[model samples]
Target: MSLRTSFAAHRRTRARLREERAFERLLARAPTVESAHELRALATRR
Candidate 1:
C-alpha cells in the first residue's frame, strides 16, 4: 500500500482503539442496568 493509505489506516485504527477504551471506561462506571443498556444501544448504533 501507499504510505498515505497506510497512515490513514493507522489513524483509523487509533481512533477506534480510543473509542473502545472510552466505551470500556463508561461501561465500568455504568450506574445501573438501564444505563448499561443505553450504552450498549449507543455502541451498536455506531
Candidate 2:
C-alpha cells in the first residue's frame, strides 16, 4: 500500500480504539438505565 493509504488506515484504527475506550468509560459512569441504553445504541451504531 502507498504511504497515504497506510496512514489513513492507522488513523482509522486509532479512532476505533478511542471510540471503544470512550464507550467503556461511559458504561462505567452510567448510573441509570436510560443512560446505559443510550450508550449501547451509540456503540452499536459505530
Candidate 3:
C-alpha cells in the first residue's frame, strides 16, 4: 500500500475514535432518560 493510503486510513481511524469518545462522554454525562434515549438513537444511526 502507498504512504498516502495508509495516512488516510489512520486519519479515518482517529476520527472514528474521537467520535466514539465523545459519544461515551455524552452517555456518561447524559442528564435525563429522554436524553439518554436520544443518544441511543444517535448511536444506533451509525
Which candidate ranks first by lDDT, i.e. highest?
A: 1
- Predictions ranked by lDDT, top down? 1, 3, 2
Which candidate leads in TM-score? Answer: 1
Q: CA lDDT of each candidate?
A: 0.94, 0.91, 0.93
- What is the per-residue lDDT of model 1 for residues 1-46, given as tens digits with 9 covering 90 to 100? 9999999999999999999999999988999989998999988987
Q: Between the candidate structures 1 and 3, which one is better when assessed by TM-score?
A: 1
| TM agreement with the true structure for every prediction | 0.83, 0.71, 0.79
Task: Estimate the TM-score for candidate 2.
Answer: 0.71
Models, CA RMSD each: 1.1, 2.0, 1.5
Worst 10 residues of 1 by lDDT: 37-46
| Residue pairs of candidate 1 with colliding backbone atoms | none
User: Model 2 misses residue 20 by how many Å?
Assistant: 0.9
Cα-lDDT of candidate 1: 0.94
